[model samples]
Target: MHEDTAYPLYNRPWFSVWLDAGGNITMKGILAPAIKPFTSDLLDLFENEKPIGTIDANGMIVADGEQLIFSTWMPPIPSAAFDRLTRSQFNARLGKNTPDQVTISVTEECPNRCIHCALPDTDNRESLSPDAVKDVIDQVIGMGTT
Candidate 1:
């Protein structure tokens, strides 16, 4: 494999920067094999200091000596949740008020506790009554989760 020197976006010697769609910045790989020997003091600097760089909305970034365009990944967020997050982000950035989606743990008692279940397979957990659940929903809605 050859390193593409033509484009230095993700080819930084030590660490490369990536920007996500939600306007979040993160480093690709801060610990490279070549820098393993000289990382004693560098590790602290990476943890405490924020990377200084300029990124524009056009997807262009200025880091080090050159300007580059970087790529980022976003894990699959469920459509409903993604819509809520997008709406909340837009409202936050624009100083607008909006209702954020509320996630309530209604029940932990699963009828089908399969072999590969994500939740704990405990049968002693008690589920909330329908009235209790409704009250919780009403309370959340009153708090602006509507």
Candidate 2:
């Protein structure tokens, strides 16, 4: 399966430059904050180049035309609970976990034009019909999910 299918908002070049009010370029994502003017070297680095790097939830920065890119954030054992527990205990905890019973999307239609809303950007604007909603509730009840 494609990585994009497995993950939402996945881009081949997932990096986005943060810019200040003065139009000066800042570092990628939330990692680097200090703003600096885009130099000729920086422009060259961005073009016709797949700079070898790993950009995770915490982003990264490449400067001075270097091949070896570094991650801004280091993942610690994949989970915070790992630091306090043994491997066996961690496995047991996960094995004993219960998944969420149900997820109900009540409506897709919204009247408000909120600036942050992604719904307006999507093609789908139809909401579930009253009968369809009733059927969903009935099915949920039959499955013993609240």
Candidate 3:
């Protein structure tokens, strides 16, 4: 029996040992998984405490240090509350002559047990009401360019 027959869904490059139709065990493919080392000097660039030269879709990169950059985009906030917080923060920062981007954590009820999470453990979690959230949005838009 081929190992592929036993685990048809396994598409990884390596294969495991399996028994043949005659009940004899045989090595069907590579016994151990292959370890592909990083081929570029990119890893070394980051290792030396340097900033990334360019960030890919996943943000991995190699670059010179001391480069100042700013980016703003919609963050992962609840659909209902996203616009308000985004606008408010944008306005506040703009008023100070330094517009800062904001990233609001809409849902405090995360399932993961991360050690650094700041959410309160109590069942009685407090969140913004729909009407109040709308008010915040109105105030933000009333301010100015975001």
How do the predictions measure up, each by TM-score? 0.28, 0.26, 0.26
Worst 10 residues of 2 by lDDT: 1-10
The models' CA-based lDDT, in order, is: 0.42, 0.36, 0.34
Candidate 2, residues 62-133, lDDT tens digits: the string is 232211221122122222221222232223445733222445556667776689767667678778888988
Error of 3 at 65 (Å): 34
Q: Residue-wise lDDT of candidate 3 within 12-83, one digit each (tens)?
A: 247433222222333234632321132122112112231113233444432321211111243211222334
* Collision pairs in model 3: 1-20, 1-21, 52-63, 53-62, 53-63
What digit string (tens of lDDT, one per residue) describes model 1 on residues 48-127?
23333334344355343232222122111222333343445445556766566555556777777577765565656777
Q: Is candidate 2 or candidate 3 better by lDDT?
A: 2
Q: Candidate 3: which stretches are off by over 4 Å? A: 1-95, 105-107, 113-117, 120-124
Measured over all alpha carbons after superposition, the RMSD of each candidate to the real structure, in angstroms, is 15.1, 19.1, 21.0
User: Highest TM-score among the candidates is held by which one?
Assistant: 1
As a TM-score, model 1 comes out at: 0.28
Local lDDT at 10 for model 2:
10
Instruction: Report clashes for each candidate as comma-separated counts.
Output: 0, 0, 5
